[model samples]
Target: MLIVILPDDSRREFDDGVSAYDVAAGISGGLARAAIAAEVDGELRDLHAPLVVAEANGTSGKTAGTSPAARSAGAREVNVRVITKKDPEALGIMRHSAAHVMAQAVMRLHQGVGLAFGPTTATGFYYDFQLDKPLSEEDFPAIEAEMAKIVAADERFERMIVPRAKAVEMCRELGQKLKVEHIETGLAGEETLSFYRQGEFLDLCRGKHIPSTGHIGKAFKLLSVAGAYWKGDASRDQLQRLYATAYFDKKELTDYLTQLEEAKRRDHRVLGKQLELFTISQTVGSGLILWLPKGAVIRQTLEDYLKVELRRRGYDAVYTPNIGKIELYQISGHFPYYSDSQFPPIDLSEREGQKPGEGERYLLKPMNCPHHIMIYKSKPRSYRDLPVRLAEFGTVYRFEQSGELNGMTRVRGFCQDDAHIFCTEEQVADEFRGCLEMTQTVLKSLGMNNYRVRLGFRDPNGDKYVGKPEVWDRAEASLKAVCESMNLPDMSVEAGEAAFYGPKADFVVTDCIGREWQLGTVQLDYNLPSKERFGLEYTGADNAPHQPVMIHRAPLGSMERFVGVLIEHFAGAFPLWLAPEQARVLTVSEKSEEYGREVEQKLKEAGFRVTGDYRGSKLGAKIREAQLGLIPYMLVVGEKDAAEGTVTVRDRLEGDIGAMPLAEAMAKLQAEVAAKTVRQVADGGAPPPPIDRGPKNEY
Candidate 1:
């Protein structure tokens, strides 16, 4: 017999080799029916897999195993519980099964179709296929009907483990070349592999799928089809990706689909065009935003807001050239380290010290850190000069692949709201706190109150990080302590999201459509002060030279992406102050044309961005046009207003705030803009994107 501990700390004895399903069945048939998966000693896996006497440390290296995998199998007992539909994790399992069912339906509908990969996402699942005939939305009805039929048939999903050689043979027999390539290219050293099969359908996957097709209810629908390169490699064969979504219940699925529709309505690219904010011209190049006059005004407004905050925090604004010598980046470890994302370096070997391997080439800057570090090195400093804060709205260039560029959010040439701080060890906490406060202030001012802080730590398995392990450990510890000091209950620590140089406090928020965006960030570092890089330092109170720890922060992240998200967040009906055309003077008739010019000039003289629409149009028609443009206030001047020195006020979304004196209306607009009011809206309730929402891992 084996001992299994329940969540409530109760121990139950079961026969040897008993699976979690057996234990659930013994407890209650209802539990057995509701169970979609299992948690065995903290590992979520197939419910039918044996709980074990003991098992070797697998994917999660949490439990220490003294023996090898061979000896560890069935060695000791572990805690066990059947996972039910109520658990959020079970949704992924069900969705994974839905992918298999989808693949089966696709195979049935078309002959000679080659399957690539199918994986469940946060909200749904998508499968990739290579076929002679391209699939489209027109084929969705037939595909969905076939999927429904498969679910009705109720075939069990069986798992099997086979030696790598045998798995290759099986895949070859099924004519799945991609599966063979995956194993041969990456898993060639593995001893064995696991696969799941449902009726006649089979695919290679690392899975924890639902027990049977029947477990996937009729709450799934195919969404859309898009082009995807094999394995996400542009050089590989092009394939079609069928996007689909699933949920535990039909209502949940309905809600999700409705949210997706709303997302489409709020898409930033569409909104950008509609509002005449920004554009991307092919001749000018892709992923480079050409801010129109209106968009430029909004961006300038945001910049002014940020500048005031930066100064209030004691940050000194500075500027640097767009391109720098390669040696500078080599010192900062960005040249060859981030070469893939950087533009090709320009050769200037003819110049002095511009030798081939001497780091003498000129390249577009990938980041702003190295330049600021140079400024810090330009002069010697005393302990009194500790905690030097530098800021810039610096534009940087990157070589993003063509397929990845998306409007303002993922642009090649974008200006970062970048800054770097050099402070002593003791000042690290205080400086970090200051940056955090600034970040919170920005979010609050923008009315984005719903956000979570993420501590980005290095991944033990990744080689991308620089610096000594002990140094990294201390840096991570200090950052974590700062986060704890803030007493944020919703903050989370995510491994492998760190920047190349150090760990960071990343501020992440979701857009209206439930997509998470990592916006603001603050980082701490000690490695760059070493002799190999720029040895930045300040005289200590002890009169000895001490290296200063550096903090890299960006509360707004980038002017481009910030504006992009704001446009979506506010649905382009900007607040009174930030609106490009804050208020428009519409004439009720030609009789009010003189009054309109006077009202427009008065608002403009008051430092408000106002425009006059004196076109000979109907009053009702002109009012609708102003509203469609999302102007914050529509100031109408007619016979009554022209004669009475009063202006009729109509709020953008609100019908009207009634006729008020011109001075009174001006005051109201000024107060709102000065306050930078951000009215918080419920999730998916964000004034739908005039919209909508990163960088390399940002979006």
Candidate 2:
């Protein structure tokens, strides 16, 4: 007999080898009707999978497409529960089934299509296929139509487990070379394999599919098609990858689709060009960004603002060379661990006796930590100088693949608002809190209020870390404590997202139109200052040398990405303080041209980013152009206003506000800028309105 425990803690006895479907049916017909898959002891599996004891310490956490890991050990029994569409795992199961339905549709339409792997992603699912002809948007309608017909047929998906020999034979007979290779190599040590059959379609897949094709409703889409290398290897067979998405109901799908449209409307790449803020040139190179004059102005303004805060917080600004000796990275343990993402090291052996990994080969600085460590080590330190903070607007380079580069958000050469704080071990907590406070303060000052704190830690399953398990545990506990103390509303921990050296607290900010971005971060590193490694030390009150705990922080992760995010967050209409061109003076006629010049000069003398449009063009055209440029304030100087020594001020959002004394107008604008006021403009006007984006994809 098998005993199944319900999620509510009730237990029911079933005959041995009874499937999860039977268990759900025994409980209630409604549950049986809604069951998509089942969870056996926290492991997601097919409804038809027998409820049996899970061997050894193996977890049933594996989902569709991942198949099952070797479960040779059986120290305990497996618990079971049915999974419906309401559960998150059910979407994956549904999407996996949807992938099979898509594959079947494609094969039915095309005569000689070869299938590869189809996996479910966070947003959707995609299948790779070796097609004889090219596919495009025009084919999507036809493909979706075929999928609808398949779903109407109500075909059950039957599972078949076979020995390795039978799996190989099946693949050979089906002419699925990819499946044969996956069975032979991908599952190299497996004693058995699983396959599923639906109607005339058969696939080498371990599926937790819906009972039939009819269960896959119309709330699915074939979004786009892209070329993909088989198994993601550039040297392997290239296949056509069909991207898609699915949802439990049409409304969820509709809402998500709406978000995508809104996202497209505010996409930074589109706004970046429309606003002329930044550019990526093919001639300059793929992952490199060119900050135009206007974009440079915004970057400078941000730097100026952050510099003041950094200074107030007791940070000493410094600069580091763009390139350093490769040995430095080796000592910092960044070389080969991060080597794949770094530009190839420059070999200078023939001339300078430095080649590859052996000698003084140079590498473009991939990180700023190593240089800051060297700066601290250069001078002797005592306990009184406990917290040494060095700051830099440091430029670093990484070799981001061409495909992954997206505008300024993902670029090769970018500057970090990087700072390193070296303090005593006892001060780690306070210094950490200080960093958190500083980060929140800066974001608040910039009006970037919607952000969540995430703790990034090392993955226990993989080994690419620098510190011992205990050290990582301590560092993670420390950072987690800092976050808990903050009592943030949406705080969570993300595994496998840590720095190589230690855990970190990352600020993942969501932007307007609902896209998430990783904007800023603060990390804790005890391993970097170890005596066995960098040998960095400071004298304690005990007169013995001890290592100072290091806090690596970047309030604004990078100038390029921050600016990109800012462009979208405000929809290219920056606030008065951050706007590239704060205000423009327009002349009503040639009579007021002289007054407009005087007005522009006065504002500039008062330290405002003001310009004049003494263009011979029409006054209406001038105002329209300024409005399109997203200029915050427009000052009109005509014969009457000039004679009266007053200015007719027009706001970009509120339209013509009214006339005011020149002094009052200047003071009003200045006060707004000083306060860092976040103006709420209407959604659509000459200039797009600013939006409030909560942290996206957060807890």
Relative to the true structure, candidate 2 reaches a TM of: 0.89
- Please write out the lDDT profile of model 2 over residues 1-699, one tens digit for every residue: 455667887777676577899999998999999887898877777887777734558543222322133122222234677888888677777888888999999999898788898877767788889988999999999999999898888888998889999999998898888888888888889888888888888998877688888878889999999888766677888899998888878977777677766667767898878888788889989889888888899999989998998989899999999999988999999998999789999877667665545555899999999999999999999989979999999999999765457788789999999999999979999999888888888788767777788888999986889978998898999888878987964898989889989999988776545556777889999999997569889999999998899999998898888888888778789999988899999999888998889889999999999999987889899999999888999998899998999999999988899999899999999999999897844232221112222111210
| Segments of candidate 1 deviating more than 4 angstroms | 53-75, 335-337, 347-359, 511-515, 531-533, 679-699
Write down the TM-score of every candidate. Answer: 0.91, 0.89
Least accurate 10 contiguous residues by lDDT in model 2: 690-699
lDDT of 1 by residue, 1-699 (tens): 465678887767776678889988988999999988998877887888776634464432123431354235543445777899998688878888898999999999999888888877666778889999999999999999999999999998888888999999999999888888988986877788888889998777777878889999899999999888876788998989998988778877777777777767777899999999998999998888899999999999888989998898899999999999988999889979999889999886656566675546788989999999999989998879988999999999999876668788888999999999999999999999999989999887877766789999999889988888888999999999989999863798989989988999988876655556779999998877767578887899899999899999998887898898888777787777688998899888889899889999888889999898998888889889998898888998889999999999998767778898999988888888888875434346422211121101100
Clashing pairs in 1: 53-76, 54-75, 54-76, 266-691, 267-691, 694-698, 694-699
Regions of model 2 farther than 4 Å from truth: 53-76, 158-173, 177-194, 204-208, 231-236, 352-359, 680-699
Best by TM-score: 1
Quick one: RMSD of model 1? 4.2
